[model samples]
Structure formats: structure tokens, C-alpha cells
Target chain A: MTETTGTNTRVICPKCRQELPWFALNTDTMSLCTQCGSAIRACVFPALLHTHQPDPDLPVPVAEGDASCFHHAGRKAVAACEECGRFLCALCRINRMGRNVCAACLSRQKHDGALPNLTTERILYQQIAWTLTLLPLLVFPFLAITAPIAFGYAIHAIRQPPGILPQRRWPMILAALLALAEFALGLWIIHLMLDDMA
Target chain B: MTAESPSYQPFGRSTLESSLAYRIRHRLFTGPDHLLLVRQEGYRETYRRLYFRDIQAVIVRRTVWNRIYAAWLGTFTLAILLLAAVLAVKQSPPPAALIVFLIAWIPGLGLLINAHRGPTCDTWIQSAVQSLPLKPLNRLPLANRFIAAVRQPVESAQGTLNPAALQAFATDSAAPSGRGPETSSTPATDTATIPVLPFRPYRGHAHTVLFALLLVDLAHSLFRFHSTAPVMLITGLILSIALLTSLILALSRQAGTRLPNTIQGLTWTTLVYLVLAYSFHSSLMMFRLPTWNHSSPASLLQVLYPPAGTSMITTSFLVLSALMAGLTGSMGLVQLYRRQSGHPPPPPSPP
Candidate 1:
């Protein structure tokens, strides 16, 4: 676990992005940002044991027995990329998903959008499911089209991971079930109409 | 900071004062590093311990009703003073009128103090995922101190005091596969980047408008504007309907949103009360029930009690309307306050 000494802690203002001393936050009421004049409410949490430090992309020494970085030949290598076996300097090495990788490999994964750790934009399947399942109810006939779609989306959501925040899976499940029921009801209505026409 | 420390210092204490029972139901103990929330419920004691490091945020929210109440009290005081002045100008002022003026000062003074103290805010501590509410703190100072105590260790532990170093550290440790480093990010930022929390914009505007209408209607009644009763009734009915519709829209728009149970209860109660009051008042007015002289009471007894000539039904409707107006007005004030307080709405329930 990484630990930083707490003697010099500062919080970034959400509004202005100005770094404010932790003590400057008013916990009782909304604190005004000196820079932006925006009201802020600070929710203080326990500090993480580990602190992140930036690595300087320095030139590698030409001395014998010194390993050079795979990406930057001039930089001294600190560790080998766990993913691709490439020697990486402190600046080129990226720790993610419990493994260290070189800049090239990290960039490749991000470009491909294959790595969950690199994912910033997410499809909110729950919102989609909710919109499909409930919104169609306003126009009762639209349920015939939307219900199946809602069910399909809800089922699809199960295989995918939830958003960055923790959430229960029950809503999706319930939505899927309700959509299925609506779809079935629509089908039954269609069958009844056919029988009446016959 | 450890749990076993004999010198555990508490920054705040919440005691449930029950006259009928000698039971200590809720107690909050804060140490240098941890907060312990204890609840005792009839032979069962439950304890929840939260370390300062794990707490993500402490949310303190206050409703506007307290300020509204204070304003109402101030108006009441002023009205009493004006009435006293009017009485003094008379050839001989009644002793009862003087007594009423003197009696009003007690509540007026109490309300002024309450207003000066500010609203009793609801406090909640947000950890990683769950938010735990402390007993609602009444005094702003006490709430501030409690928050300071909880946040101090966390702030110190996080080492956020030195921004440059922390930023450097953050950049150095940035996961290459994750989002880009924020070390060079300037203070001037766009609001678009901020995550949009679940919120109902203009959520309480309908309620506020409805309350304002109710207040206007009350004033009309007090002034005995009989000819305008129909107009007030129609306006009240329309606003009440609008209020109900807006409330439904709010609920539907933010499905599975969790508000404090007390707030939900208050909202529902005020709605029901307003509906009943409106119905009764409108009915009585339509039937042309005799109106009382609220401004000029024949005696203190007449002022305190219902007039003898008025039917019991009329009296009841009048009284109920008055009570509901006050209750709903306060509720609306609270809703308005919450809307203005700048706290992000609670996160929607997960699907």
C-alpha cells in the first residue's frame, strides 16, 4: 500500500479546480470558492494509504550494466512491462488492472477500447432499459415495439459490467421481466385481433 | 484512533429524549480517527464504525422553512404591534387587546432566536457507496465541529495539504491505460466536464407557488374579501392540482430516488392536508356560510373560540383551512430551501 504523510493535504475545488487546503473547507455549510464564487460542499473521506507520484521522463545513463527503456532508448529502464515483456522506465510504465505495462501497450489497449480500466464513456444500460420500459406506457401502442427492445437491452446489461459506481442488478432484471410481460401482452392482443378478423 | 482506546473523545453526542422511557436510543462517538454510531432499540444494541479514511463526504442540508417560519413570526409580531397602536389611538383601549399584545411577544421572541440560530440541518456521511445519516444536528456550530472532527483525520491522512506534490505524485502514478494525467489541468475548467447528478430542476417550484397562493387566500379570508372568494377558490384548486401533478412528475422523473423518510412523509402529509382543506373551504364558501370578523373580534373569547352564530361545519372548515395553510406553507418553504441549498440530489437506485 502506498502511504503519503498527511501533514500537507490539499483538496481541489470542484468548481474552480483551485487547490484548497483541507482545513479551508467549511463542513458545516456550503463553502464559497475564493476564485470562482461557486458554492461547494466537501464530502471528506478517509485518505487512501497510497499516494500517486509522477515519474520524470529522464534520459537513460550510457553507463554499462544499465538497462534502457524499450520505448525511450535514452531513458533508464525501471521495470519490465508485465503485459508485453517490454522494458519500461518510471515515466513509460503504467500500472493498471494490477499489472504494469509500457506506454505503447497502454496506448494500444486504450485505442482499441478493449481495456475496462481505460474506459471513460459508458453506455448506461439501466437508463436505456428504464426509458424503453416506462416511456412507451405514455403511448400505450408503443409498448408493442418498446417492450421487446427493453427486455433485450436489460438482458444485454447483465453480461456487461455496471458503471464505475456500485449498483444493484435487480432493476435491470425487473425491467427485463416487465418488458417481457408487456411484450407477451401485446402478442396476446395481436392474436385476439387476428381471431376477431378471422 | 484505535477502537480500544480508553480516552476516546467524542466531538458530538445525539441523545433521544423520551419522557415516557429511560432508554438511551442513539449515541454518536467520535475519536481522532473513527466515528461510531450506536443505536439501542429495546434490548438490542447495534454499532456502526466508520474510519475517517473511508469517509468520502459529509453532507449537511437545511430546509428554508425555518427562515420562512421566522419571517412569519416577525410579520405576526408586526401585525400585533400595529393593532396595539391602533387600539391606543382609540378613546379607551380594551384590556383584552393589551393582554393579547403582551402575550404575542413570547413566541415572537422565541421565533426570532430560532431564526437567528438558522435551520436544523440533516447530516449524512457518505462512504464509498453507502451514506449513513447522523442524528439531525440542530446547531450549526455543533454540526460544523462534528464535520471538522470527522474530516480532519481524513484530510491529514490523504496528504492533500500540498497540492503541487500531490499532483506530481498523481501524475507519476497515473495508469497509462486509464484516463490521461490531470497534473497539468488548469484551474479554469468547463462545467460540462462535471458529472450530472440525478436532479429534478424546478422540483419544488409548484409547491412554492401553491403555498404562496394559499397564503394569499388566507390573507383574503382575514380581510373578509367575500366577493373574491370564488376567485381565490378557483386559484387554489388550480394550484393544488398543479402541485399534485408536479409532485407526480418529480416522482416519475427520478424513479427510485431515496430522500430522507421524514421529507417524503412531510410532502405527502402536506399534500393530503391541502387537498382536504381546499375541498372544505371551497364547499363552505359555495354554500354562503357566514364569515367571522377575524380583524375585529368582539372579545378575547371570540378571538380564541369560534363565533356562536356560525355553524359548526363552517367553523371547522375555517379552522382546518387555517391549519392546513400553515402546515403546507411550511412544507413548501422546506422544499424551496432544499432546492436552493446546492446539495446534489441523491443518486438514483441501480438497475
Candidate 2:
């Protein structure tokens, strides 16, 4: 039940909040918690002793002949929103994606999915291509419809960014090849059926 | 690397995690000043950046999920094999049933792959404002490599916490710290801090009950294995319901408990074993149902426990289940006893 008391930050065990001994932290080896005895490792930096500071430069009252904020008329303007060209106070300004945007424009951009920073999920075309190419094998009848689509998608994905991380081109390449083979097999089966009917 | 450098090097291998709703692949990339975590789900990629200076600590805790996952895959693989065995025993197994035997290798290979990946762990980065889990660092080896890769840059940015300074700070609470940026606008200087609370020992009542129930289940399984009296059927049904209830209760109650690690681990293992045993028994029952006569008065008993009519494979599986239950139950009891006696088991030795 021991806890360290300080305003200054100290590295504590994530499981048990007991302050880890100096030797236990930032070591090449794992250490046990003094209280709970869980095998835990902590890599502490100088940041462990540092506290977060609130942002300064909040909006100030407008002075005589000072530029007033577009939204907050009584406050002095700090910067203009890049998207809307409106003068914004420091409080209204949102700095993201290296652009000084107003809150309204930022909200609109997030809603439209135009801000990549706000996006939490993505649909990977390469994975979709792989799924389409492979999963259809279980239901062989659907190969006729999926193979061409999979081939086209994989080809399209080759020219585009696969994802944020580097991806191997092999799956897409192999999917295209497999799709072609599957299509050929489908066509061959259809021709055999026609020959039998004749 | 300079701050202006645009190129980002890949920091770790991309790891994929799946849930019922979504599957996400996570990758780590190192920028000059920050580490980027990219989560790719379907057609989109989400990025999170943790700056070097902002990172306070990277904590990695060992977990038993890797073994549990291996066991889960093994269970499915075993189920497939058991089905194949039943088919082989039948004089006329359907031709399509042969596919079950062949496809069992998929989960078998999955089990092998999971085992090859080594142990699993949970790694989290604690900043002042938030704690974020790094899903890409779920394995110990990967987590170590990632920690090694990011250590130098972060240390370079913030400098290291030497032992003397840490000891000095540990002794005196009111001493003025000479580290980090000191500014008049710093909020920590003006804000009131919360007092630390004493830790409470979690009384794992549900876990205690669960462990005891597993022992009872083991005893019941043994007794049922030997003699299939009609009373054993009722006892078996009651034990199943009680175990189910206790498992649900134990899972819900075990969260945030300061129990010993071994006990915590045993709890999870018991859960997995329960799932495996239940699934195996259910499949066995389904396989046996086809041979039962609808009009027979002893049909229920025959399907449930068939004293003299059980196959060698079924008998072997039941014995294995009893042995596993007994092992987990006894281990849990020993750990719980040690914990209660104020002599908890020592933490696992580091590798």
C-alpha cells in the first residue's frame, strides 16, 4: 500500500502505483513490483520527472486600434484561420496538420474525413484484394464473379498507396496471377460443359 | 536524425489483431522527433504520434494470452481430429467428411505458428496526459527491440535519470527539482495535486469459489468416468451450471485486483480450459445423439454418460479433461493458500 507523495512526477508501476526503486527502472532486466510482485519493466526517461505545462498565449483583451477576433469580438486576434480567412483568437485557433485552422473549419474538415489526422480507421485495398482472391476458394462457384473483380482491384492497388506502412507487393501480384488462373479455369469448365451438351 | 527530416523508418513489424467487429494491423515508424503508430483497418490508416520528450515511461508486463491463444487453436484442432476419428470409426463416413480431416491441419498449423511467436505481453506508453497501449509490441521480443530502438532518441531528448538523482528525489519530497523546463506558465506549479491513496488487497471471493468448483468438477468427472449411475447425470448437470455461473462471476470480479500473478494466471487458464472442455463435450454429445433411440427410457443417461458403451477415444478425452481440471484446480488452491497465509509466491524469475 506504499505510495510516493510528490508534485514532481515519479515513475510508478503501472499495475501497482508503488514508486519503483531507481534500480528497477530503465534497466536491461525486469523487476518485480515491491507490493504486488508482478514481473514488470519500466523504461523511464527524464520526462518522468517533468510535469505537463498548460499552453500559454491565450486570447487577450483587444486594445485600441487592435485587430479583433472574428468570433470573439472583444478579444485580440492572434492568427487567421487558413481555410476560412477569418481572424481567430488564440483560443479559437486549432493547430493541426501544420495548419492554423479555426475550430469551425477543423470540425467541418473532420466531418468530411478530409483531415487524415482525425481518421481512426482505414480500409486497406491490398487486404481486400487478398480476401477476395483467397476466400472465394471455399465457395468455388463464386470464383467466376470474384476473380475478375479481384484482378482489377489488385491492379488498381499497385498504382496507389497500399497503406501508411510499407507493404509487400507480392500478395497483390500473386492475387492477380491467381485471379487470372481462376478465370481461365472457369472458362475451361464452361467450355467443357458446352462440349458435353453438344 | 534531424527534426526537419521527412523520411520515417519502420520501427517494428506490423502486428494484426482481430476482434469480432474489426481487424486492425498496427505498425510503428520512427520520425526524427516522434514515433508514429499507424493502425490500418480495411481501407484507412489512423496515425498517432508520441513525441520523444513527452514519453514518460514504456512499461511492459508479461501476459498469458499467448498460451491461451495456443490452447484455443489447439482445442479447435483437436475437435477437428476427434470428428475425423469418429468418422473413421463409422463403417460408412460421408466422403465429404474427409475434408474435415484434411482441414484440421489449418488450425494445427495455426497452433504451431502461435507457439513459434513466443510469449505475449502488454506494453503501454505513459505520458503525462494519457497512457496508450502499443498493440504492435504485444510480444516480448518485439517489445524489447522496440524499446531498444526508441531508447537512444528519447534519452537524447530528455537525458537519462541517473540513480543518484532518483535516490535524492526519493528521499525528499519538497526539494525543488532542477530537471525539465521551468517556466512561470507551468500549470503544475500552480495546481493542487491529489493525495495518493493506500492500496487495498483484493479479496478474490469469486476466484476462490471458481477454484473450489473446478476441484468439485474434477471429482465429479472422475466419479462419472468410472460409474454412470443415473444420479451422476443430475450431479453433472448441476456442476456444469454452477461452474458456468462461477466462471462468469470470477471473470467479472477479478478485474483491478491486486492478487498474486500466479493466481491471476490460473484464473485465465481455467477460463480457457472450461471453454475447451465444454466445446469438446458438446461435440461429443452431438456425435452420439444420432445413435440414440427416441423411445428408450434410458436415452438421456445413454447419451449423457453411456457407462459401458463409450468409445476409447471419448474415454481418453474425458480422462484428459479430468486431469487438466485437477491440475489447474490444485495449483490455484496452493497459490490461494500461500496468498492467504501472508506468504505469496515469489514473482517469476526474469529470463
Candidate 3:
């Protein structure tokens, strides 16, 4: 797999890491690997043709009468941080999804998970709530203990981030209604049991 | 979100792998600038972003998971139908048999759906960072659509390379270079230029041991069926333990290694056999074992070994076990010999 990123944008066979012929790449037809003869279909994009350029990190020295960096007074300001409105030098500026942000603002976004791009993982509260409501139905008696908890969880899940793509509210709504019904049934059963005891 | 920020559209969704315990789902979302891979496992979701400008290639390799899934479902459905037929012949209630027949339809429908989806495949996206599987594109049709959607944006971002340039780069990459030919190189260019290293092929010591153990078990099964002596029971127990250890060793060792196709197939066959054998034997034990209490350690011995010369089910089970072991063990040894004798191995099977 690492061989795919070989010297001059070489497209290798996925199975064997053997370099594919130029004709094998970007073709609609199936191609066979030269070494391990595994059937392969590949689409080589233009990114393979163009090499990536690393951004320059060294800051330029500040000149007289020029706007200096907020973090480093001696360095020239290249861009303003999108979040904090602070002037940032080349080294201090972190270009993320076309936004020039300072290290501090970037770290803050990462910690707060305010930016979707910065979030590596998220908990799907809606799924957890749905599972809570549905799984207890197998043992009906447990519904008395779980119904209110499920309803509460569904309400709490609404304020959290749904998912990367917007989540549908219908499933959560259905779960809440079911929980309510289960709670009512549980209350009736408890009342009947208490009456018999009395 | 800024006005200039790219808007994303849903590309495709696929269950990458699933079992009884958990399932990992992959959903691809495409934006003008990049493609996002969101993987969901239980309540947690993780993200991987592959920029169009960084994506080098999209590769699709064929796999046999589709066929394997179909076979499993078909076998399960057949077994259920057979059981239902047996119950009907025994004059079981119509509703009882009907219920069993209806249950078979679940896996029957699953088999039909699996077949309809066409062949399975493993799709990978090679980027500047590392090559990772694009699980959402697990089928050829899905991969085709994904490639079509991604190609235009990527080409527009970085200009297309002509055949002549591609060929030149292929030749240049095959040999060696200081910096890449046409494109502006990065600091990592030097590392990418390193020659491809040779990989070691797997030596099948575990496989040999497993085959040998299977043959030993086959012989032991026949011997234990003829004699009811205490020594025979002890020997049977020891053989069972050894066979189980070898099975585990062989299965684990073959994973991620380039083993011959014949050996791989044999390993899988043995796995299927073991699972079936265990299920049947455990059910039989539960049905026949007299004492359920833990207080009687002596009666528990009957659960381990079906009483010899007692029942038709025990005799038939032992016979079936011996037959399977003998056939598989012989086949394994022949395949191993063919491999050692310089015969060309068959095409590699998908894991």
C-alpha cells in the first residue's frame, strides 16, 4: 500500500504493490497485476501527477513601520486569525480548510469541538437512546425501570451533535412515544399488583 | 461555516464488516474540495478526510465474501428446512412444522439479497499520507460511481497527466530518482523514492501440525468407537485437546500471511467442520446427559464422550467425524506435498 506513493506518482497493484503499467491506470477496463496477476481496476487522479508542496513555516523578520505578529513582535504579520482577530506570522498561522487561524484558536477549536473538521470522533447519543428504549422490550418487567430513563435520554440527545450528516428526528421521536406507552403500561401493572397485595 | 466553504453531498453507505457483537458502517460524503469517510461503530463515530488534491489513486480488488455469504446462508436455510421436514415426517403438529419452515425464509431472503448485490470487493484510496480502504465502495458498482464523482474534482484541482508523462513517470519510479519528474516535489519525496522491499512468504509449519493432528484424531475416533476401556476415554480426551489447540494455531497463523490457496481453503473447511461438530455434539450432550447438577463429577464424564455401543446417534456421529477428519487430513497432506514439489499454487483467495 505504501508503494502507491512511490517516486513519480506510480500507481501500484493494490494486492501485490507491484507498479502498474501506464495503460493499466485510469482505464475503465480491468487490468492484471504483473507480479501477482490479481485482477485490478484503478482510477488514477491528477493528484498523482502533481507533487504536494509543503507550506513554509519560517517567519519573515519584521521591518520598520510594518504590522508585526501578535505572538512574535519581531516577525512580519502575514494573516489575521479568523477566530480571535489577532495578527499571525507565517509560522503562527495554521491554514485549516481555507481559514487562517492562530495556534491558540486552533487548539481551542480542537478542545471545544466547535469546528466539525477538527472533531476526530463523536458519540451518537440518538443511537444510545434508541437502544435503551427498544432492547428492554424482550423482558417486559424491566420496562418499568427503563422507560423513564429512555425518555430522559431522548430529550437529552436533542441538544448534542446528531452526527456528521444531520440526523433524522423521527427515530428519536418514535422511541420517546414508545417509552411513554411502556411507562403507562408499567404504572398500571404496578397499581394492580399493589391492589392485590392490599 | 463560510460562504466559500464547500458543501457536501452523500456519496454512498456500506456496512464494512459485521458480526453478532458489533457492526462497523462506512459512509462517504463528497465535497468540492475533499471526501469524508465516516465510520460508525455502536454509539461512536470517527472521521477520515481525504482531500481531492491529496488522493493519488482509487483501486478496487475483487473478493469472494459475496460467495461465502451466500454459501453460509444457503446452508443454514437448507438445514432449517431439513429439520422441518423431519418434524413433519414424525407427525409433529402442522403449526410447529410451519413455524420452522417460516423461520428458514429469513436466511433464504438474506441469501437472495446477497446474490442480487453482485460480487464483493475491497476498495482502497491511495493518498499522500497512506493507503486506506474506502469501505463504502465495497462493490464494483459503488466504486465506479465513487470514481466518477471524485475524478472531475480531482482533475480540476490538479491537471490531468497525459499517457506519455504517466509512462515516463512509471519508468522513472521503477528505477530510482532524486526528485519526481514533472511535479513540484515535497520533503517526503526522498523517502517515497526508496526501493520496494521483499516480503517473506509464510512457511506452513502450523498447517502441517494441524493436518497431522487431524489424521491422528481420525484414527483415535475409530479406535475409541471399538473399545469402551478407561484408557481409550483418556486418549480420546487428550486427542480432542490437541486437535483443538492445533486448529486455533493454524487459523491464527494463516491470517495476514501469503499462504497457498489450497491450504487456505483447507483451513477454512476445517473451521467450518469444527463449528458444526461442536454445535451438534453440545446439543447431543445436553439431550442425553442425565445429571444437570454440578455435584456429580462422575456423570459429567458421559457428556465428554458419548457412551460407546449404546445409541445409533453416537455411532453415526463418530463415523461422520472420522470420515471428515480422514478426508481433510489426506487432502491437506497432498496439497502440502504439491506445494513443496514446486507445483504452481492456485490463485489467492480473499480473507
Candidate 4:
């Protein structure tokens, strides 16, 4: 286990869905859930199987997601903590973002925090629509930059789509591939046009 | 094309084969064994679009030249002999016998032509009837059907049996043994079958022995007038009939291919016919009664062989010849009738 950065705390059991007491577990310190007695992992929520509550303080996990060095907390905030509205010091928290959050407020946050976004499908659709319109007209170089950028914000706009929606991912992926082919052909057309001009 | 697509498809292989079989049963023409009948998807349509319109298809195979020649041989001999007899009897010398011989060519060529794109010929009737369902024909006596099946092919061939099968019968008594007892119980037993001694119900060789009877009649003619020329011709005709019948059976079957072709058999038969007929003419005159011997060669000829007796003799020869040929013709036709009519044994009691 890493040294306690006062921000670390314990949270509920995702498997049994039980609320747990503080200090009951740590990254290396093993224990069980007080309510259900399920073996508890000291690892923060997303890192382990089963989902815990989303962070109330930070924006929902963004596209630029990673182990963040929280300057105020001193512990690396690998996941956003869901409890108190602050990036906290290690000893003051419990596990969040699969890391320990400060001991206090883990249960309060588990009940109150909002969840991660689910709009990947909407983003995927909008990007496909954008590319289909743009790629045919010799505009791929411009389309590539704008579509992927907008794709990010669009993906974050809603909660995660029902897991079932991934079935539609294949056709969209196929569309994306066709778009790539069209982009290449479009470039070839432009090259020919330039050759004719010269 | 669009309608043909299966909305729901069968998943098994045999199911597909059964479907194809069902299609064939509904669509294809089936017929007696000799004229090759084949069922295929595109061919029937192709034929319909061509040589014939009403028929789905028509296939033709011409009679082999030798069979045609044999047919001509029978018809020519019968016609010429009859014409000569008629002229002599009428006391008017009509056209020469050679012209009559030439005229006989029509029967050999014309048996089938009489039907003329129509269905009067029993060959077509029998052929077509063989393929139809046996049920509707329930009114036909079982005996009739049996006789029809066995005799049909032979009857159609005139006196000739299928050469290959009959000769095999001559050489090997067991040659045609493999075909069932049912085939045996019907028709002029194809002498081509190899006799399976015990199982073969003794059918007297009544058909084949008719030749010997012809020879004896020729011999009686020789002793009566004792004319060498008449004796020779009579003997020749008798021997020719015997030899042609046997050898045609042999040669046509082409069974003893190692020995010779039908042409050789036919050639020898024809030579025998000519020689024996020549010998009979001279022998009959030479063997005439002693009292008829006269002074001059002309008187000697008349006295020895009186014109009335000669006419009677010629008429007798012509009648006998026609009778013999016609009888053989009926025998073959009857045999053919029996074959097509004969019922196969009730499906052998399941194992």
C-alpha cells in the first residue's frame, strides 16, 4: 500500500453493493464489507470490477482520463473522488478513481454522486453524418480535425448508452471505413485536378 | 427469377434430392426400354422449341441398314414370287418378275411411313401404352397383359428376335437365364436366351422348325414333276429361309462378332437361296414321270412338264411362300405383343 495521503477513505462494496466503514480496507490492507461481509478490495471503484458512484466534485470522467497529479491532495488522483467537493490530501480521504479517498464522506458520496457519460453512440452517429457529407467533396483534411474534436464533447454529453447499443457500433465502424476509402479517393481526385491545372 | 427464391429453405441434403426426383416425375417423359428415354431439365424444352411443336421432345434413331436390308429381303421375295404366280394363273404375261421384285421395296421402307405423323401404328401405341399407369387398364384381362408384354417386341420385329440375345441363347443354354421366370412364361421364348434347362419350361421350338417344313415341301415338289430347275429353286428357297432365319438371329445379335458380321450370314443365306432354288427347278423336271418323255425337246418339255401342272405347281409355291413368310411375320409380331403385355411378377414379397 502507498503511504496514506490524508485524503484517502473507504467506500462501499460494488459486488455486494454494501456500505462499508472507514479504515476497513486499504490498497494493500484487506478486509470485508461490514454489511454483507464480502471480501473488499482496497482498490478504488473503476479499477476493480463492478461500478461505484461517480465523483461529485470533479466533472464526470472526461475523454482526457488518467492518473492525475492533484497538486492540493498530494496523492495521485487516479480517479476523481466522489465525496467532499475538493481534490483532497491523502489521509483526509477514501478510495476514488480506484484509489483510496479520505476516510470520511465515502458513503455520503456513494449515494449522491452523478455517473459517467454514455453518449458515445450519439457522438459516433454525428461524426459519421459529418464525414459522409464532407469526405465526398475533397474536404477530408478539414473534416478529420473537426469531426474527431466534436466527437469528444458529444461523447461526454450524455450518460453511457445501454450496453446493448454496441451492436450498432459495427455498422458505424463500417461506415467509418468506407469514409476512409472515400477520403483516399477524394485526395486522389484533387491530385488529378491539380495535375490537370499544372 | 425473383419468385424462385425460397423464403424458407430446407436444411437436409436428401430433401433436395427428393424435390428434384419429384420434379422429374412430373416433367419428364418415360417410355419402353429400347428407344432411349432420358429425363433432363433443359433438353425437353430445347426439343419443343425445335423439330416439333406439340411434343415436348422427339428423338429418332433410324433402323440399322442391315435390319432395313433384311426387311427388304423378306418383302421382295414375297412380292416377286406372288406376282409371278398371279401372271401365270391369269394367262397374261404381266411385267417381269424383276420389276415386281423392285416394287416389293415399298413394304421394307414403308411399315412405319403408313402412320405418317399419326398414331395408327401399333409400334407407337404399344410404345406409348407401355409407359402409362397400369391402373386405368384394370379392365384388360391379366392374361392379355401378360401376352402383350412378352410378345410385343418380337411381334414388332416380324419373325426376327433381338439378334444379340437370341444367338447367345443358341451358343449358351444359360445365356438368358438371369431374367426372371416371368419373362420365360410369356412370348415366343427369345431363342437368344441361354436355356436354363430345368427352370426353362419346355416351349417346343415350333417357330424355328418351320424352316425344315419348308424344305420338305420343296422336296415333294422335286419328286412330282421331276424338273431340275423347279427342284433347284424350291430347294434353294427352302434352305435360304432356314439359313436366313437362324443366321439373321445370329448376325443381327452380333453375338459371335469373333466369327463374322451379319453381312456374311446374310450373304451366305442369299447364296444358298439362289443355288437351292436353281437346283430345285432342274431337279423337279428331271424327276418327272417317265410316261411324259416325248420325241422333240419342246414336246418332251411339255409332255414331261405339262403347263397346267406347272401353273398349279407355281401357284402352290407362291401360296406356300407367302404363307410361310406371313406366318413368320405374325410369330414375331405376336412375340413382341407378349413381351410388352407381360406383367412382371407381383413385387417380390418384401424380403
What are the Cα lDDT values of the candidates? Answer: 0.56, 0.73, 0.75, 0.36
Expressed as tens digits, the lDDT of each residue in A153-195 for candidate 1 is 8998776653322458998899999999888877777788789
Off by over 4 Å in 3: A1-24, A32-37, A54-58, A81-84, A93-119, A132-152, A161-163, A173-198, B1-8, B16-23, B76-106, B177-180, B183-266, B291-351
lDDT string for model 3 (B1-351, tens) is 332334568886656678898889888888667888888888898987888878888888776567556656766687677667866887878998899899999999999988877777778888765787887777777788778878888888877868777776666555545435465354434434446654345577788888988898789878876776667778777877887888898888776555654577677877888788889988887786764556565546655575655764676567667777777787788878877686454444547
Rank candidates by TM-score, best first.
3, 2, 1, 4
Docking quality of model 4: it rates as incorrect
The estimated TM-scores of all candidates read 0.41, 0.67, 0.71, 0.19
Position B73, candidate 4: lDDT: 52
Per-residue error (Å), model 2, residue B284? 3.0
TM-score of every candidate's chain A = 0.59, 0.66, 0.77, 0.28
Is 1 or 4 the stronger prediction by DockQ? 1
Ranking by lDDT: 3, 2, 1, 4
State the lDDT at B249 in candidate 2: 85
lDDT per residue (tens digit) for residues B1-351 in model 4: 011111211111110113644532111111221221122232121111100111111111111233434444555556555766565567664555445546656664554442332211001111211211111111112213323442443244333234343333323322444323323332322333422222112122332343344445445444444454544445544655665565454334323221112233333443344455447656766777565646766555554445334565554544444444443344443543343355232232334
Provide the global lDDT of candidate 3 against the true structure: 0.75
If you superpose only chain B onto the true chain B, what TM-score does each candidate give? 0.51, 0.72, 0.67, 0.25
DockQ score of the complex predicted as candidate 3: 0.40
RMSD of each: 18.3, 8.4, 6.6, 40.1
Can you rank all candidates by DockQ, best first?
3, 2, 1, 4
Evaluation by lDDT, superior candidate among 2 and 4: 2
Q: Give candidate 3's error at residue B49 in angstroms.
A: 1.7
Which candidate leads the pack in DockQ?
Answer: 3
DockQ values per model: 0.06, 0.29, 0.40, 0.00
Q: Model 1: runs farther than 4 Å from truth?
A: A1-39, A43-198, B1-5, B8-10, B13-25, B53-65, B68-95, B98-106, B126-130, B136-139, B150-160, B165-351
